[model samples]
Target: MAVKSKSVASKIVLTALVLVAIFPIFWVFLNSFKQLVDIVSTTPKFIFTPTLDNYIYVLGRDNVQHGLFNSIIIAGLSVLIGAVLGIPAAYAVARYPNRFSDDIQFFVLSLRFLPPVAVAIPLIAIWLDLGLYDTRTALVITYTLLTMSTIIWLAIPAFSRVPREIEEAAIVDGYGPYAVFFKVALPVAAKSLIGAVIFSFILVWNEFLIALMLTTSDAKTLPIIASEFTLLGRNVPWGILNASVIVLSLPPLIFVGVMSGFINSALKKKD
Candidate 1:
């Protein structure tokens, strides 16, 4: 009886935690469909008429569309470039351990520890000198610092998990170091690498501070555009703001949903 009671209590705690976590997102989602009056009403309206005006208003703007496109381009390119560079670097660190290897890994990890403002301040001057300011190219290059560090840090363990024996077997079959990495280690670690890429993508996608400092107009991201809504003093446009929140959230949600199968496989493999 005591064991059963404990199990029930644990389940109750877990369910409560889940509800608490989900409630804010659910509240925003609910409000996105509401009109201004319904959203700000003293009493919550549970059964008010829903409208697509919020969505239409938010999506109709040209800046929102451009910001969305810039976000996609910047996030996608950063992840792609970071993966190409960081994966090989990770494999090298995992497979080839020297006196400096640990130091190198730590240095890479240390980049992530620095606050965004610290990195952005110096980068802003450097970018200005190079005449790359307010360009997507500038953002992509800057964002690689974020994406590459994350990928390398996460992928080191993933690459380490590739069996040494399999690599040796590939060598016996006439595979060179590069071939072994490409053929044996990479294929084995693909699922875990997918997880790492997804994480890096989300990180770069949601990044706002550095982006805000670097870009003025042509390279503004969705988060930057969403922030503009909050600057409206009295009116606030809660409905449009909530609508923008939903819009901002959709890409990451869709990316995760599309990659759910690989994510599940990766988890199962880890298990």
Candidate 2:
């Protein structure tokens, strides 16, 4: 009877915690249906007619659709570049585990500590001088700079999870080092790679400062578009602004859900 009571108490606490975490998302969803006037009104109107005008307003904008496409391309390429560079570095670090690997790891993490404005000043000037400003390439390169190290960091522990003896046994069977990596290590660490790709994509997609400085028109992204929500002369379309943000952010939220599934499956393996 005591144990049953404890279990029920625990369930209640867990349910409460879950509700608390989800309340903010519920609030945003409700607010998305509200007009700007209703949104600003002090009294909460829980049961009102839902409208789609905010969505229409957002979709009617000139470059919002195009900017979403640009955001996807830039984020996709960043994840690709990060994966290409990060995996090899992680493999070497896992396989080598020496001073050179340690130094490189430190250098990569150090990039995170530097303030954004400090880096942007020189980066923008350099890109402008080279005629690379306002281009997709600038975003890709900057994102790679920001995201690759994180992938490597995530991948290293997963790589280490593979038994060294298993790799040596592959080597003894006449497979080359590269073959062992592709055939042996990669399969074991597949979940981590997926996690890294999702994380890197999210990082580049939400990147604001560098995208603001480097790209103006040809490669503007959703973050840049979201910044233009307020018109100086007109009252801010708070409803449409929030709706655009909600829509623009949906893809990343979906990615995170998919990642959660991967994590669940990976944990099921228990190896």
Candidate 3:
């Protein structure tokens, strides 16, 4: 009886936690379909006529479609560059343990721990001086600081778990160092590497501060564009704001759904 009671209480607690997490998203989704007047009402209306006007305005006005495109370009390129640089560095750190290797690994991990605001001032100044501000390339390169750190840290453990014997055997079988790394070690660590890349892409996709500071118009990302909806002084456009939130949230939601299979496969392989 006690075990059953405990189990029931645990389930109640879990359900409560889930509702707390989901209520905000549910509220936003509901508001996204409401009219401006309906949204701003003192007493919230449970039942109302839904309209597509908010979404229409969000899509049609302010070149939001362009901002979405810029977000994709910046995030994709940043993760790609970060993965390329971080993978080899991680492999080296994992495979070869020396004073220099340990130091390099520590430095990389330390950068991730540092707050972005600490460096944002000087970083923006340098970007302005170098004429790289407000460019996609600049965002991609700047974002690598965090993305590279993520990949290096995550990929290190993945590479470390790969059997050294497998690498040596591949080397003995007439495979060069590069070939062994690309074929043997990489395949074994591919799942973890993919996870690192996917997570970094998601992180960069939702990034606001650096994107806001470094970009103004030409390269403004979706998050920045979402914040722009409130620039119209006194009255906050709740409908449009909700609509933008819904739109901004869709890509990440879709990505997580799509990547569910990949993550599951990685887990299955480990088991």
The TM-scores of all predictions, comma-separated, are 0.90, 0.86, 0.87
Candidates arranged by lDDT, highest first: 1, 3, 2
The per-candidate count of clashes, in order, stands at 0, 0, 0
User: What lDDT is reached at residue 174 by model 1?
Assistant: 96
Between candidates 1 and 3, name the one with more favorable lDDT.
1
Candidate 3: tens digits of C-alpha lDDT, residues 95-196 = 878879878888988997787776667778988999988898888888999899988987888898787899999988999988988999999988778878
> Once model 3 is optimally superposed onto the true structure by TM-score, how far is the C-alpha of residue 251 displaced, in angstroms?
2.5
Give each model's whole-structure lDDT. Answer: 0.91, 0.83, 0.87
Predicted candidate 1 versus true structure: per-residue lDDT over 30-97, tens digit per residue: 89999999999999877889999999989999999999999999999999999999999999999988
Reference-based TM-score, model 3: 0.87
RMSD of each: 2.6, 3.0, 2.9
| Pairs in steric clash, model 1 | none
Q: Give residue 152's lDDT in candidate 2 (0 to 100).
A: 87
Per-residue C-alpha lDDT of model 2 across residues 1-271, encoded as one tens digit per residue: 9999999999999999998998777777777888877888889777777888988878777788878888988988888989998988888898987878878778878888989888887999999999999888888888888779788877886788787889999999999989999998898778777887787777788889988988889989988887888762478777887788788778888887767875675466655
Residue 6 shift from truth in candidate 1, angstroms: 5.7
Say which candidate scores most in lDDT: 1
